[model samples]
Target: MTLLALAGCSSPDGGSQASPTITTTAAQATTAASKPGSRIFGLSDNQTAALDYLTTLEDRHAPFVSDDRLLALHRGGEICVDLDNGMSFSDLVASWKPELREDGAKLYVRAAVEKLCQDNRSKVPA
Candidate 1:
């Protein structure tokens, strides 16, 4: 929940960084992914597409673009870990700061789960 709000590689003991996230058309995602250096090496093209996809989301609901991409990946992994552990939607939402509670937040989380958190992709909240 609130943990997702933190950028990658962040924890309660450490502060988080800012990044951009939000909605985009599949075409935009593809176009972004096509650009050289658009993706960090070591990730599959699909994975990179996912990252680019996240960037197109509405920032208020899924703010992820302004942060370092590596850290963003870290956060997505953490979210998957929690999901794998049976973290619930209620609990997830409870962890959010009031201002961070946006309707699209769940969708944002789901996209990360599906794209970045492969093992937990099926665990996305209902």
Candidate 2:
């Protein structure tokens, strides 16, 4: 009876959720993105210019892109760039759907980006 009860208690799905395995490449990128400094790589001149412009905006503002904000923005951009060179916030989040099930860190990274983007929308060039 106890054995039957135990079996009955098992999840109908038959397996526990699996954790996401953050790839070494992703990890490295994340580390770089999370760093407390300006990031200059893999950007076209235009993109670099745009980033520079944003930095200027940050400097002008009282609560500019702090370390955490920079990390989130950079990491989010990295994930987007990896999934699709021209990926936007919506696109990157969509691509990371599968990863969210396994690892929440990706979601965290994405959220950080979203927040940064939201906060900096005024600074973004049209």
Candidate 3:
């Protein structure tokens, strides 16, 4: 999916140059599973794990997509998901809805999810 499509964009701060748009294919979205089965605060294990992973990735990569757009990308197959993971991609996307207002964290989380889903989908039998 097109992580960023802007050309010669300036940072929101008005001085720093924005990072170039980064695009990743399903093949480039692979991610290792880290969190195990353990629901937290009513969230499923998969949802919790996804959130954790996204947060970690966010610290390193500033996201260029919105939470809603990210989910759309996943649903549209721009992002892939592993059916063997025993997690519902829909549920994972839904879990992110509540946090959409959490500053810029949601953007990073969404981008992470997109890559993760793409990676998962690519691994499935096709």
Best by TM-score: 1
Using TM-score as the yardstick, the better of models 2 and 3 is 2
Model 2 Cα lDDT, one tens digit per residue, 15-123: 6544333233544444444432323232221233224333443443313223333443345445534433344545555565564432344344333333322332322
Q: What are the TM-scores, per candidate, against the unseen true structure?
A: 0.44, 0.24, 0.24
Q: What is candidate 1's lDDT per residue for 98-121, written digit by digit as tens?
A: 534545456555655555444554
Per model, state how many residue pairs clash: 17, 1, 5
**Predicted candidate 3, C-alpha RMSD:** 12.7
- Backbone clash pairs in model 3 (N, Cα, C under 3 Å; residues 3+ apart or in different chains), count: 5
With a 3 Å backbone cut-off (N, CA, C), the pairs that clash in candidate 3 are: 80-117, 80-118, 80-121, 81-120, 81-121
Q: Order candidates by TM-score, high to low.
A: 1, 2, 3
Q: Comparing 1 and 2 by lDDT, which wins? A: 1
For residue 104, what is the lDDT in candidate 2?
41
